[model samples]
Target: MSRGYNGTEYFRNAPGLLSVRLKTRLMWDGRLDGADLPTAVRDMVTEAHFMNADGRLIQERIRQIPELLALWREAFGAQSQPYGPQIFVAIAEFLKTLDGGDTWWTAPCAATR
Candidate 1:
């Protein structure tokens, strides 16, 4: 389990057995950090679908998906490629999948209304 600065439980029901860096970033973006990545991902995906599709953030988000995050954690933790460029193309491909509609890939959990 992890708690946000506000003491809001970002992730629970799972113990600390496997709280990898990727999970931290995902929950940070999608749930805890107030980064609004899910909203940003959705917006950028829409723009890329119908517009220039060559923005820095859009490209960055592509690189920040789950698979790449996992790859980075493993590679970095193992002292492999210290920097991350191998993930760029893959992330771009992922962004390509975000064509206009809402992508469930990084959708935030529905806030309590």
Candidate 2:
């Protein structure tokens, strides 16, 4: 349901973030290293067919958000800035918490009883 800013539809459907921690490879083509989540996030953000965002611009805009800045300072250190890499790392950390463990999808089928 999403398209790039340039109006191009992605060739492959975006996969769900669920259980990403258990994946050994990411993306439909498995081009990215799943063990390196930060890199995957950076690629998605910078890719022309994806976010198409400039890292410098993203950091500059983030610097203006007081709440986000406060969070960055608290998370990284009092002197930390909202640099692009840290942004990707933070996003990757958040994505790691999206695991679907114990959800109904993991439960045995009741009809099998």
Candidate 3:
């Protein structure tokens, strides 16, 4: 019911992700927890309508790339192997920094201007 990756579907445009850290609910219908971004990322990535990605497959793929493996090892210690939850958590942390003052609800006057 929303936009997706790789030209997968275009039934409805997805909402922009900027300023999600300020939201109290997530997704078009607010079905996800805005405060729990890692869970949101996990849901979106695994959902067929969204990224349609398998975490195990993604982990395997990343494991094959030496540079990515090295980076992961550096960040997560040498024994880590691109675990799914860890990856989602890292992505959520990065997303937390994506504030562009873009949400109209957070700045109604800016939207009217």
Candidate 4:
């Protein structure tokens, strides 16, 4: 767990924000309501000792990257602009696609089955 100045500890895995998307409560303490993933992501990004980034500043920084902008436009179309909500939602959706299969630990387990 990563501890902040105020002694708020957060989990590193952030599983609810990753593979397990259906979880209701997030963070190590489970204080954040997980009903809305985008909102949760926004909170994480702006939280102290976390990303601590302003949404508009993040948007502008992302917009400055042409390649990233092009990729976002291609993947989500023009309507889905790279604003704070869209960026966070897109990142969450992308993280959901990453499977922890085929690792050494899983491989050994699979062979035994």
**Model 2 clash pairs?**
none
Model 2 worst lDDT run, 10 consecutive residues: 104-113
Candidate number with the higher TM-score (1 or 4): 4
Ranking by TM-score: 2, 3, 4, 1
Off by over 4 Å in 2: 103-108, 111-113
lDDT measured at residue 6 in model 3 versus the true structure, 0 to 100: 70
Model 2 lDDT per residue over 1-113, tens place: 55765888767777888889889988778887888899999888898899889778789888898987888888899988789988988999999999788666555787644
Q: Candidate 4 at 41: error in angstroms?
A: 1.7
As a whole number from 0 to 100, the lDDT of residue 31 in candidate 4 is: 76
Higher-lDDT candidate of 3 and 4: 3
Tens-place lDDT per residue, model 3, 1-113, is 55577766657667788877989998767878788999988877897778889789778878999998998999999887799888899889999999885456666576565
Candidates in order have lDDT scores of: 0.42, 0.84, 0.83, 0.70
Q: Give candidate 1 misplaced runs (Cα > 4 Å).
A: 1-83, 101-113
Model 4: CA > 4 A from native: 1-18, 33-35, 78-80, 102-112
RMSD of 3: 4.3
Candidate 2 whole-model C-alpha lDDT, 0 to 1 = 0.84
Candidate 1 residue lDDT tens string, 26-53: 3323543323334333443343232324
